[model samples]
Target: MTSAISVDDVHFAYDDEPVLRGVSLSVEQGAFLGVLGPNGSGKTTLVRIMLGLERPDAGRVELFGQPAETFTDGTRLGYVSQHSTDADATMPVTVREVVTMGRYAHAGIDRLNDADHAAVDDALERVDITDIAGRRLSTLSGGQRQRAYIARALASEADLLALDEPTVGIDADSLARFYDLLGELNDEGITIVLVEHDIGVVTEHASTIACLDGELYAHCETSAFLESDALERAFSSVRVANAHRPVGGD
Candidate 1:
């Protein structure tokens, strides 16, 4: 079977500053991959390159066997961005309406047909937010809104889902539920890629883990990652720095 995502010797830089260097990894179909790193580690930049939002300076990216640049199957990949939290809360759109927008990629000139409406309903049901489908986005709690966003991505019937910093600002209970939902989606054969900060939680949940710190630190199964020297090196630097801090100094 073809890999869901493939990045070969990828390199990226911002002006004179390099972010990613010789990074290469592949995610298989139905795999749940968790990408972990500190801030400014190029995690976001790597994501943009995968989604074709930004061009890589070197190497190549392929999505489902097609080059990222030439791939035009918009409906095949679903994306839930970190900025969803900041969506204009005052905008008076219902949950169902927001989810329905996922179908816009395939809607063409005609408005939502029966299939589109059915898809919206199905997505809402899958996310267990059918009861609140009519609620305004701003009226829902944090978890509910996050579910609605995931439902919107599902409305596209995408096989690959990518979420960036999805659990930021969410309560523990909500974050647990959100992760459960992701597991369910992955169980049903949707490949998942999550960029996250919580190392323990991500390592516990993800089938595979990829570590980055302006470079590829490690990419391995969760079990192997625990014993890998790469992980030690990655966090050892942080530990050494923290140890040197003066007790009363900033």
Candidate 2:
């Protein structure tokens, strides 16, 4: 019933080049909203503006009814960015340590309290990474490492989880398992916003879809979107084949 994220007529640009033009969307609470777009379609830029990491040239963004620029409570919003091999390659921290870092927003300058420890433990278990909680982050496989990252976000007990291209470079088996985990989390009532390029996969999992190609082509229920011409407008070539295919089918 409540909106987790609301973007109203947003317009953004990089220098002289326009990126997003008149984009508007509203993601309801507990909704798994998938963002699909081609390269340079401003999907990531729109997410950044929603997270307050970047400002839009025009229009306003709200998170949980509060202005994105003014909302300072980050503990309630969790984010997992695109694969960053550089940042993870040289890290020396353990999985538990990484997950514990999420509590920093709440704990501030203090040490981890009892509640923080409980949260971290629960998160690790939720992601099925508790067995490797003490393992070095750099030593784990790609799938395990990604689970650790998700655990870190979960430790914050965030109500909204946003991921940008989360399944990139992972094996098919791992990707399937990861999507299953996301479904479990969503079942627990966490609002999910996923930025993905794969139309079939996003359609299968997300309840709502937003197609962006510098402009908002469509933002509606996944079923409605699949039945409309919006996908053809935004992604004419590759998506044309999958546009009519029922979601979750080959």
Candidate 1 lDDT for residue 244? 56
Q: Model 1, 171-247: lDDT tens per residue?
A: 68677777888899899999999998788888988999999877789999999998877766765556335755589
lDDT of 2: 0.87
Give the number of the best model, judged by TM-score.
Answer: 2
**TM-score of decoy 2:** 0.89
Worst 10 residues of 2 by lDDT: 236-245
Task: Give per-residue CA lDDT, model 2, range 1-250, as digits (tens).
Answer: 6599999999999997888899999998899999998777888999989888898999999999999999899898998887855767787989999899889898988887999999999999987889999998888887778778888899998989999987766778778878888898899999999998888999999999999888999999999999999887786643444554577755
Clash number for each model: 0, 0
